[model samples]
Target chain A: MAAGEGHRLHRLGLVVNMVGGLRNLIFPLIAIAFGTSTLDFGYLLLVGIAILFIGFTLFFSWLAWTRFRYIIGVEEIRIESGILNRNARSIPFERIQDVSIEQKLIPRLLGLGEVKFETGGGEGDEGTLAYVSTEEGERLRELVRDRKEGAVATPAPEIANNDDGTADIRRFEPEAEPLFAMDTQRIFTFGLFEFSLVIFAVLFGVAQQFEFILPFNLYDIGAWIGIVEDSGIDIDAISWGARIFGAMAALASLIAIGIATGLLRTFLREYGFRLDRTPKGFRRRRGLTTLTDVVMPAHRVQAAIVQTGFFRRRWGWHALKFVSLAQDSKEEGSHVVAPFAQRPEIDPIMKEAAITPETLDIGFRRLDWRWWFDQWALLLPFALLPIVGLLIFTDVGARAALILLLPVIAALFVWLSWRHCKKALDENQLYFREGWWSPKLTIAPQVKIQSIEISQGPIARLRGLAEMEFGIAGGALSIGGIPVGEANAIRQRLLDEIVKVDFADVNRG
Target chain B: MTDCAGFTPTAPLAIEEMDVNYKGFGAINCLVSAIQQRHISNMDEATETEELTRLHPDHVKVTRIVASLFMLVLIIPAIIAETAAYLNQESGPPNGVFIIPVLLIAAFFVLFMPWRRYIHRGFHMSADRIRIVRGYLFRSDTIVPFGRIQHIDVDQGPIQRRYDLATLTVHTAGNHNSTVSLPGLLHEDAIAMREEIRAHIKRDAI
Candidate 1:
């Protein structure tokens, strides 16, 4: 691990690259297999083409493996890659926000991991080492941490140094009590609430793509009916009660399948979910197949979000996430510290992040009443169009006019949302509580707020109401339908707090 | 003065001070009429105000030229359609009727709308923050504190360069409304503004 020397990835990366290449060729390989059964002389030509394709894939994978190299320097890490374009990227030690190690199913078995460097500059990982030995990844992470701390002029934490040129991987192990961990029972309870129909969609896609091997046409309803009759179940001769019972049985089976899929997905993703406080940050380790190890520093946590779904809220279950500059995943911008926890369980984690939890005595103020009326007025016309059309164009009688109930139901929802949406600004933090069914509470410190906007549309101006949108670093916090006076007061108050702090001092910790 | 819509523009009216007459309408209709009346009254308030600074006068001319170019895209196809219909003579309408309205609409958009938009947009800089107000139909007032600025950029397009105008954009760490741009400034003024804001921006703000 000499500085300024370029190192190639482990040779096992070639196997991983080849597997990725072959995965992309599956459709064409399947097509060729089907073609070989239909033609005689064409079979030899297809086989030759298939062999050439596999040879080319293997050649390219090997070439790519040979081309990729990374140089861990004293001040920066440089990566050189690309087959023809030849891309060289240099990331300084101070710019990197965090380092994570991820091991997918194959790499985990091979005792290899992918190291990702998050720069907090954009949407994706700034630098990555695709396949390296787990021990090497850990050593590289520690080296980068030491260099970054050195650049910041801060004393490095007490860890066994590698001054004698020996790798000490065990020095980075977690020794304190875990902040949060999910056992099998809690995971199963979480799975019950996460019922999904994704399995059915996957099954349908498989049937569509590979239906040529099936004996019957899958889409033909007549063929399905014929098969049912062949099984000695006459559809027209069945009793009404029996038909109702059969339909219920079908629905029950669908529910059962959905629950099974949810359980399988949850178990695979949250198998050994654990969160621990380490010297570097709050470290999270999870996943049965694709293990991910992420450490989010406490100072970088700009805001905290407590989320709960409709049923989960009823059962007193919540998830806590921290909004940081580094993204947790491609789709989620916040890191989930506790996927499933109760109010008492989440308090300590929030405390660790320096975010105050919502208390019972906090005064939360509601938005203007026009917030409800504005939504109702905007939606009622669209809802009335269909009901009015039914009443005027057709002779379906009064039953058709029952569609008018749609607007009433919509009005009820608008009222509920307006009632639930509230904001509370304490001495140091801003709390926004939104949503009726699946409520989300966002807590942002006043010093972290970047900008404040007070917007008024034509209708809002008439009602003397304004929407206040707060600009946070990695999250959105807005409260609409505030009276203009209050909106201005809040804006001034927040601005006064934002300008007083020196950001350099804030970043040092 | 009343325009084609029989609506008059007046001095800027605050919501509480205005008298909105809604004698016979239902609650929703009353709300709708109140908004319409306020919109019409405030239309002329786009004129100069005491605290805010209007964009350079040449901005109106630049906007007019750009709008006219966009109108060409619409007018060319419209003229072609009219000529083809006249040649066919069997199914199309009379020749001058269609072209007349289309040309009139294009003229209204190209000749008049730019000045209206130019009047409505204004920006003001205070000790610590910049406030921008724009759009007559959908008014938005955004304020960005100088301490929150991550970077400042002064950009000038080809047309803007000819007019000696530039746009100053300040970037913040916020995801929504992260970059606030104030266009239609003299090139030198934009640069000065950028430098001033840059001076206020502290290092490692995020």
Candidate 2:
């Protein structure tokens, strides 16, 4: 790593610490809102700030003081570093479940990569090595994996001749070779689209943040101008030139805000971005200050979720999330490799990760029946809420207020929900694919399932519909809107198959 | 989880099946609670010895008859109140007068239906395994090979004590949905069932 780059990284960390520490100062306000005593809230904030300060100081000092050294031995990669307390991490070869790499525009320009290590345990069990070059990261990963998998070996071959040497032939070990390399074109296409979307999202976020800062309602200005005429504020009495200038001023302000928002987003989202593969796992390191490194392992991942939002679908950009242990849900604890991955890039990555045509993508069954059942079941809440609203309004003018509100909201919800109940299942897995805007497909392996159950309510029974629930180590995801018999049959088959497999790593050998 | 990589166990074709019924019990209970305002004051006794003892010696048929009669007596008034309210809502009094009665009838209908269903939904145990298929809306079939049974517990509620009966529950490693209760089982039968399940577990372990 270059000394200049290291200095920049240290400065970025200090900025992040200072910004994050600001949260502690506001903690007392939250504590008071929650009904804590003022004294207690003050004490809480004091302790919190102290902890934050100490933690940030130690982290920044360590980053500045230490020099990182790494090496690949047979079947393992060892990273040794520390200023005061020397630290060494040794990751074994077989345990190297995933090796992925990424580079952002800045990192691409700087030729740096962030490497992550995913241990597939409970929280706080994983580690990451960040801000190294992409080439070194890939080389280290290859060395460890080849050594572990007992693949072909070739000692280092010198790419350059040294100034004073006869022949500067570098010896490369057998283990130090990359098993996979990404296509540059696909990566570039993906990065370009993702970079744009992130800029848009950040701008939107900033606009919402500045919503309260505006003193007047710019949205109501046109209507207000008409009102001014009605209220006898003689707009015709004012000069025509002044009116034109006022309108132009408003337009300029709006444009200026938009431009500022866009610029702020671009800088924040793209700062210090890089994605890369390490010896232990796939790594995504991003953010200038408060740098984040996400490491994901292959074996520990229980499911893969592919998401495509409305705009992304048109551009063929998508995101992938890995469902793993103790995450509460598939959406949580995910390592986002890219904010946007183009279809060409996505397809190959999926193929390499064993999540493509041969595996997860095969034999998916769309759950049309769930949509129908959900529509019917929705009637319960439809009936219940209206009745409650009527009852409440009858006495306290709640009805008048609710009647003016509830129908439109409820109707909109029902319409949107109807569009979102679609699902797909296959012989080996079930895809509970739903959502109108943010579509998510949850893939569950049959072997990991704990039980399968089918149930019906009185309304569902009348409709001849049943709900099928697939229970796994996590929790149950129920599919509604299938015929009772069909759901039962599917449930039975799943259970039968589940009982047949040995899930606790007993049969993998 | 240890691997015997090349080994695979044969799937069972079929096992001998036994019909067990606490017949119409769960459904009856569900309906009785719904339609009848007459709340059960003796549930503890009903679930214990009184209910269990009915399956033994000579009182099995007698107890069933007595329980049916009790439910009928409790439901008749609720039916009358609701029918009267529905038919004569205008002439005699407002429907509000019959609200309690209507609620009682609804309660009885809800309770007895499910109770009778539960009674009808008993486990069919054989020498090899136990199978349970349940749910009025979402039906599920749970198969527990007796060999896989880790332990068995014979539970007697206050009512079961009065009837001298017991409910048998089987536990296993994959025991997410493993409840096979012989609600009206005689004490001796419950003990025998427990022993049988325990023996299977022991054999499977060996």
Candidate 3:
């Protein structure tokens, strides 16, 4: 493996670019289709353009190939790129948080891996080696890891020119033990339960693409919705109230399709999900289509969040994500620790992250009941205003009955949310629990908190209520509609804990 | 100094005594205070690397004008429609009359925003962290530790460029509220702040 000098990405990187450029080629093909029949010899032009497109892809790929080279310096890793606009960046070894080695289909087929170096500093990956042989990727990761570890241990590193250099290789191999495994069957079930909001968008895009590509006009799902509305299911049938039956059916179908596709996606991405604990960090290997292996070091992870949908929570199923600098599988900035987890599974995982809320019987302070009223007031605009407007402006009939049901459901949602919300302080960690249907519990260490605050609105002030909010690494969390005294106490506690300054001394001024 | 080992307040200041002195509180004040609650307590003061710096007061004019221009741009269609409707009497009463007051209210916000920000928006950089306090009604004070800050950017809009002022945005890890923006600083100050912060981060690797 090339070590000292700057090295360019593998020649296969050009092929990777060509494969990526296929999407760009589609526009020309689309234009050709649109211009054809009207223009003479359009097919000939299209053929010529296809060749040109591939040539264009190759030319640009070559430019990118030549321009992009990374120099693994003794102290820092330097990446230089751009043809017309020359750009270069040097990320020091200490700054680099983690190195993730990923292999997509093409890369895997070619025995290559994409290495991304992350520096908790958020400007995205500090540096990325687009395509390298799997061995080279591992070697590079090991070399970087050594430098990073060595830098912390001693002021300077001598391992690069060690007597045998066997120490470097030996330490790379951590005693990894299998901690969690989500087999295909479990993943399938997990996927079915993992209903995402993205499905609506996916369906919309797919429907449009299908409409354009298909020779025959496909059934208009929108028309089906209209048909249901026109069916005139008895509005007077109060016992069997199905006023918004059509809308409900449409939504149910959408959810059904979402679950099905979600299942396929889950199977495709996490077919052989496995989690292992290594000396370095938590080693995770999953993905069927694009195999990914990422090491979530103990230090990089900011917090652990356990989230579950209303229905999933009932069946003791939850998804766990770690808020970290690494932009995991998606650009979520959240690494899904366990795609499908329950209280038992999550307890252990959270414990590993030092956020074990299981054994600790921390007393939680519930928000004032007036929080429900505030939620209702907030929900009124989306629920009641529309209903009132419809009732006042339009003829009140079957639609009115359905509109009335909206506020009722919204009220119940608000009530449930109000009941479920609680904030607890467990010595070093802050446990924030919210949601009724789709509950989310966030565990943030108090020392990690950057700042603390207490605020109140006119209404809240009048009611002797306030909100206590605290900021950690990833984001901020608030405990709203709490008693003013409680909020102040929480605020003072957080300030004292986070900042070394005496809250009493500071407040005296 | 009290050992703050437990997650409990050691301060003995009467709870009621700590109530916010909401003097001259307006919409902007409430807004800033609300947003501020997510970060630092009202008692927290700015901590700068050198010394705390407030935004240039002239920046208010730049932001106000820019915002008012945008509001005016939105109001143009309504004004045009109203005039067109007025010319054509057969179209009955002007359809865009209601839009005037709405746009005016929006314009009020545009005017109010910059004034409040000019008064309250300030930033500080310490040896280990950079602090920013913003919002007039909803005061928020955020401190980004050197280790946590991902990157810093100095941006200048046309008005800002003309005024020789720039906005500095410091990004931290993990997306949410990642970018803390401090607008209305001398362009040189913005650049110097960026460099200084970058240098500190580099020096203090941890």
Candidate 4:
């Protein structure tokens, strides 16, 4: 009754959210420490303050839960919320792109879900109905979807199930076909091949915080050598014995364990990675603890980026992602279409998105070599100065001088990347290929380009080259070192082609 | 495709001269006086005064004033730091530091930046497209098609209002260059321009 003539979140909303808030408090608690050995009145006072802070937070959450409500009218959903300063917004069903029902671990355990309305406006995810019963969430989503169907002109079949209807519907979403999915075995395989570096980072952070926790002081190499000398234990390579061998064996197992932990994390994150064809588009349901259901509508996808890491390339495996409007992606403006896919397996997925071989047939054009070597020459001082300084100042100069090879390797890699970095433009699609170690091939439709910027610095002016940047609705993809003439020509041609788009293409992807 | 060494185009930014002859990089004849002359389209050579409209000339004066204010702000920090150091001799840097003069001399060149920007800055509003050009050392020419414009805003600052000037910003559907700002237009002209474009968009939508 206090929440007006609209539905409130599930009864356990306050309890669930309070638990989540308490979990977040763990991070801050580490920063605010009390010396247990010196416990007194001050400690009691600090404890009391902490309790007050937590109590205040819970009180606010309770107020927010009770006040927040949304009513489903005929054409619009009116959401009213706020504990202190009230906020109200009415979103028409037609404007609601998709009602994304998310079931993270906590919500799933409580039989609750959060339904996010990704409205077409650039302002974040337009609205969210948090902590609804999972069954009620399904019902609410169905209601909104039916309303949307009735709101928009139904028989516009040519733009078949396009999420945004921003561009030409080259390919329609196939009828709810169970497309590609990862099995538990292959999920583990993908996890095995993938490496999560977060574990080492977390361990290193902990080691830094609690020096006593570390087996040895990592920074004190001189002290270590002194100990080794005093102990009459020679672990030196030149005069090695069984002790050196033991150290090597320990180091090897440590590396193995590190890799094993990384594999475990990858498994947990992508435990049930599955991609299925939904009525609107593709719904990807993945994760072990916090299950995420990301729906990528056909038209909303701006561009396709296929990336293959050095190790993965050897195995003919690549990861592909699509740039979209919503903030559903872990990576900004992009959602992973396939985490680990073979080249052959990716071909069909690309086809489903309407990025075909013919569209990519435009011969790749390499950037001018001056853009490569000129930057290298300017960057050489910054790269070499530290090594030169070390040689001049530090006793470890002779050892650090070996780092000179790193720049050489980096320059060699840059040369290879220069060879690989190329752009191709056709009537409808634009493709760019970059990277030597991990090649990324990005292909975006011409209609998706928001604007074209042809710019040149004084150096570029002298060379008759420019930086050509193509802006999409979500993320921008740019190919530098384009000849100024070619860039302008491409711009004009793109503009002319853009004018010829049919009425439906007026929207933004 | 195999060897890139021999690959070269005749003209860099002037590709396909037939289509973009009247309208592009080469259209600017002089670095300094070029702002006075409007680019004439080669296609409509018979009608010598081409289609593209130039921005109001008062724009230069306004921009120059803004640049001077910006330069003052930039120089103030260096001046204050040097003054403070000179006042506190014991804790100060090694004496006889004429850093203020040295910084001013180097920073003086920045005063010319606004002039160059003014010379390059231009906007043309036609039936189908609105083009805004800005920058001097690094130039960016943005062409926003009428069909793509999501919204149009006409805004005026106190300084601009005193001079009866307003800036028109056209926001397009594309996220990139979603809003292109064209400053230094007569206030009435800006409103009229927005209404004209708005009417055309509505007409085309149906």
Per-residue CA lDDT of model 1 for A1-509, tens digit only, reads 24335988878877777677778777887787786777777778777877787789778877887777888866667676766544445555655667899999888888889999865533343678999999989998999898766656664554566877665665656566799999999999989988999988999999989999987999899899999999998989999999999999999999998998889899899889999877677899999999999988787788999999998898899999998765555456689999989999999999998889988778998888796798689878888988889899999889987887888888888888998898898889999998989999999988887788777776787776778888776778888898665676777787778777634334344
Q: What does DockQ give for each predicted structure?
A: 0.18, 0.05, 0.15, 0.16
TM-score of model number 3:
0.58
Give one digit per residue, the lDDT tens place, for model 3 in B1-206.
12211111111111111234324445545554454343234223312113345677678788888887878766777777778778877756776675778677775768656655555555666665666655433444455555555555556666787888877776555344556777788888877887676666555543
* Residue A508 local lDDT, model 4: 25
Model 3 residue B10 lDDT score: 14
CA lDDT scores, all candidates in order: 0.75, 0.50, 0.66, 0.67
Model 3 CAPRI rating: incorrect
DockQ value for model 4:
0.16
- The global Cα lDDT (0 to 1) of model 3 is 0.66
lDDT of 4 by residue, A66-135 (tens): 8788878765676767664444445555446578899888888889998887654433545788889998
> Considering lDDT, where higher is better, how would the candidates rank from best to worst?
1, 4, 3, 2
DockQ of 2: 0.05
Task: Give candidate 1 regions above 4 Å deviation.
Answer: A1-174, A208-223, A327-331, A502-508, B1-50, B82-95, B203-206
Model 4 sits at an interface RMSD, in angstroms, of 8.0
Sorted into a CAPRI-style docking class, model 2 comes out as incorrect
TM-scores vs. true structure, each candidate: 0.71, 0.44, 0.58, 0.65
Q: In model 1, how large is the Cα lDDT of residue A430?
A: 93
Q: What's model 4's overall lDDT?
A: 0.67
**On a 0 to 100 scale, what is the lDDT of residue A192 in model 4?**
64
The digit string of per-residue lDDT tens for model 3 on A1-509 reads 14345988899877887887877789869977788857788888888888888899899889888777787776667676666543445566656667899999987988888999876544464568889889889998899889866655443443455576555754666644577789777887888886666877877689878787754445766666556567974334535345477568989997888888788888888878888766556788898889999887655566788899978877898888877535344455668878797778777877776666534478766678886787677767877777778878888756686868777877787778888898788667888889877788888876555454455554554455656666555555777887655555565565456544211111110
**lDDT tens per residue, model 1, B1-206:** 23212111211322211234322335544564466565554333222122656788788788888888888887888888888779878765666756888799887888657755665677888867887777756667677877666545556666777888877876666666677888889988986886566545423332
